[model samples]
Target: IALTDIGVGHDTLMAEVVPGIDFIIGGFDGRGIREAYEHPVTHTVMVRTYGGVSDLGRLLIHYDRDAGVITGYDWSRISLLAEQETPDPLIKEYVEKNIRSFLKRGVDNSGFEN
Candidate 1:
């Protein structure tokens, strides 16, 4: 969900692109459970938040606000950055670094640029 306009909006976006395998598609699909929602006949999806930049132009990141930190990230950038020979690794690194710094209460994740 694009929770922009908050105190740390960009931080919310950055955590998404952080390198991790925590977001495999089927990961969110509850397994071994015979829930009708999982049936192929269903077109509707069960999710909370949605909409932001991605391959499909706008992507959704399902987040559970009650517990905290991001649980997954869909690498939808690949579709959008198709012509890029080398994606902006710097931005991702900058995000991770800022996250670390912020965790240490020594720095913030904003003011970064190409």
Candidate 2:
């Protein structure tokens, strides 16, 4: 259902892994691939998001149990800006409290290593 496809060029491997699966989500180097590419054996609904300060991806899927298929879907990536108003109190608190600690953990005099 979901995959973390590292690097920008490894996108084709996502489909190649699961040939006929209906939905496949991937993140490969933030190229932001989104589409249902037609395949030889089956059609795939592939979705990916822009990485690193791009936006938040929201996906809504509708399924038909009788037909055993996904009837429809809506995919979107919301841009997060510094000027935007805070929508959720919990998230805002977590960010304000933990973001500094997280960044500090990832840094030193040499900057980010991994």
Candidate 3:
């Protein structure tokens, strides 16, 4: 397993060249991948996040303990719905406070406005 910011093309090449790499996860595109891709030749499974804080990628692997290999897997991108999911009170408060502080700071040395 490996995490890389080198993008998918390089990741594929790395999988082809490197031995014993079963999974490669990462991409340079901030938009992220819609679905996981498995290389036909190397059989390496590739997964990427949906980007940002709202969406997250989940990978469930079925591994054989004795054989020490992944037999199968399931992957999905889960959307964190605000209505369904409740934010942690402490974290929410901290983030809100930070945002308020940033807004109060106004224009910076770079002349960037909020």
TM-score of each: 0.19, 0.54, 0.62
- Cα lDDT of candidate 3 equals 0.80
Please give, for residues 36-90, the per-residue lDDT of candidate 2 as tens digits: 4434555555677777867677778899999998888888766676566556888
The weakest ten consecutive residues by lDDT in model 1 span 29-38
Q: By TM-score, who's the top model here?
A: 3
Ten-residue region with minimum lDDT total, candidate 3: 26-35
| TM-score rank order | 3, 2, 1
Ranking of all predicted structures according to lDDT, beginning with the best and ending with the worst: 3, 2, 1
Steric clash pairs (candidate 2): none
> lDDT per prediction?
0.35, 0.66, 0.80
Poorly placed runs, candidate 1 (over 4 Å): 1-87, 106-114
RMSD of each: 18.5, 8.1, 6.4
Q: Give candidate 1's error at residue 109 in angstroms.
A: 12
TM-score of 3: 0.62
